[model samples]
Target: MYALVDCNHFFVSCERLFRPDLRNHPVCVLSNNDGCVVSLSHEAKILGIKRGVPLFQIADIVKKNNIAIFSSNYLLYSGISERVMKIITDTAKNVDVYSIDEAFIDLRNYEKKELVPLMRLLAEKIKKWVGIPVSIGVAPTKTLAKVAAHYAKKYKGYKQVCCIDDEQKRVKALSTFDIADVWGIGRQFSKKLTSFGVNTAYDFTQKKEFWVQKHFTIMGVRAWKELQGIPTINTTEINRKQSICTSRSFGATVTDIESLKESIAHFTAMSAQKLRKQNSIANIISVFILTDRFSKQEEHYYHTRSMALPVGTNDTAELILYAHQLLTELYKRGKAYKKSGVILSGIVPNSSVQQNMFDNLKNREKRSLLNKVVDNINSKSGLNSVKYAAQISTDKKWTTKTSFKSPDYLTNINELFEVH
Candidate 1:
């Protein structure tokens, strides 16, 4: 059996963790640059404030309904995520962290009768210790566990934990589960299934294997098998990405060369950090810039440039240097660019990278040590506390808007919650 533990209204819950007074109030968390609604409390959803609706569109409702709005604070979310994952790892020995807000725990060793009580206890423990509500769903497969999790969160009768340990339970759950919301079934498949009158998960599984093979392919078959209580998906650590890209739409468009270069430097540095985190190095760096997509054909501008490195490296300075060069080539004068990014590709494990015979080994080691120091300092002091000067802008016109951002309560010592 596999148990999937998912946080309930994660971002809103995180915001409420500090301000207990907001627990019963309407709240909505915005995406980067406070662009749109990404997470909402039940009260917010009850007000018909849909996800991804721009902040401007909901101004009237927010003012009238008194909805608490906030900008996304990734640092706080990630810190709390690490703490939550730690508690899970300590309790469930075999666990796969599915995402920041979810994890799958292997439960095959436990007796069937112990599943619900143990999961319920775990949920209560998390609430008691971390002050965050979680829903746990246990079943024969990850996909079924996901379905069980939805029920666990939806109905208060389950006490935040649901189990589909028997064939009867599995069938009932699949019969009611929306085919579109089933794990691995996207919109395209959902529309296709709907056209064929396959509205529920049980209906999808009833289709012939050859029909599934011809229409939905291997992935769809995998989901079909998973929904039927057959385990096909690996609940192991996810594979590392072959490439890392970091890009952001600016709060306002920038046209100057210096501001654009600063943005590119920031993105390249971030991509390099991710490469180091995964213990990988990149052999190629690519940079791209874009003007407003809605602009006139003659006004819009977009271009990309990539360069292959002589040797793979995760050094931030080296990557930024290359990215600046690429950006310089891609940038065009008089174009109001709204977004830009850096992509690090041709990745290989840092330990396995071939050393360039012409490269200075000592200097490479020095750069690596320097990066490690910076990373350690930033990790301790909060992100970008010790960043390169090139990442800082005087006017700060291209920076993300965080007007409603909350404090970094978990990550920063000074911002820790106060008690009287």
Candidate 2:
């Protein structure tokens, strides 16, 4: 059996953790630059506030309803997610982290009678310990477990845990589950399924296997089989991201090369930190800059440059130097650039990084050790505590707007929450 654990209203829950008064109120968390609604509380949803709607579009409603709003605080969210996942991992040793707020537990070894009770206890423990409510769903397959999770989160009658251990329960759940809400079935497939008069999970399962295989290929077949109480989806213990890109739109447009360089330098350093965290290195570095597409004051400009490194590296200094070089080639004077980013690709495991025959091995080892020490310090302190000189600039035009961001209570010592 597979049990899926999903955090309920994760971002809003994190915000409510420090601000207990937010409970029973309409609350929401905005996306980058306070662009759109990303997470919302139950009260906000009850008010018909949809996720991903532009904040400006709902300005009147927000003011009328007195909804509590917050800017995206990724640092705080990640810290709380780590604590929640840690408790889960400690309890369910065999676990697959599907996303920041979700994990799958393998229960093949446990007896059928113990499945629901075990996960119910886990849900209670997580709520009491982390102050974040979770929904756990158990079934014979991962896809089915996702369906059960939906019901567990939707109706409070389940007590935050649901299990589909028999054919009868599975059929009843699948009958009402929307095809679009099923795992692996995105909007595009849902539209196609609805066109064929297949509107529910059970309707999808009624399709012939050959027809599904012919239309959707292996991925669709996997979802189809998994929905029919067959375990076909394979979850690896560690899945390395294919590429990492760090970029952001500035709070205000930048025109100078120095300011853009500082932004790129900061982005490169962040990307390098992520690469080192995954024990991987990149062979390709790409830099891109853009002007405001909607700005009538200047011609829209978007250009990117990519270069192959002599050797794959996760060293921050090397990445920043290369990123700066790319930016120099791509930057056009007086463009009024609005955004910039650094991308690292062709990533490979650190152990598989082949050394150049004429490389300076000694210097490489020294740089590697330097990165480790710097990372150690930054991890103990806050990010960018030991940043390179290139990342520091007197001009702050490139910084993004975070007018409503909450405190970093878990990660930053200076921003710790105080109890009065």
Candidate with best TM-score: 2
Candidate no. 2 TM-score: 0.94
- Residues 49-96, candidate 1, lDDT per residue (tens digit)? 999999999999999988999999988887777778888899987888
Query: Which residue runs of candidate 1 sit more than 4 Å off their true CA positions?
Result: 235-239, 295-298, 348-352, 360-373
For all predicted structures, in order, the TM-scores are: 0.92, 0.94
Give the alpha-carbon lDDT of every model.
Answer: 0.89, 0.91
lDDT of 2 by residue, 306-378 (tens): 9999889999999899899999999888789889999999999999887888754458889999999999987
Q: RMSD for each model, in Å, please?
A: 2.3, 2.0
| Pairs that clash in candidate 2 | none
Quote the positional error of residue 400 for candidate 2 in Å. 1.5
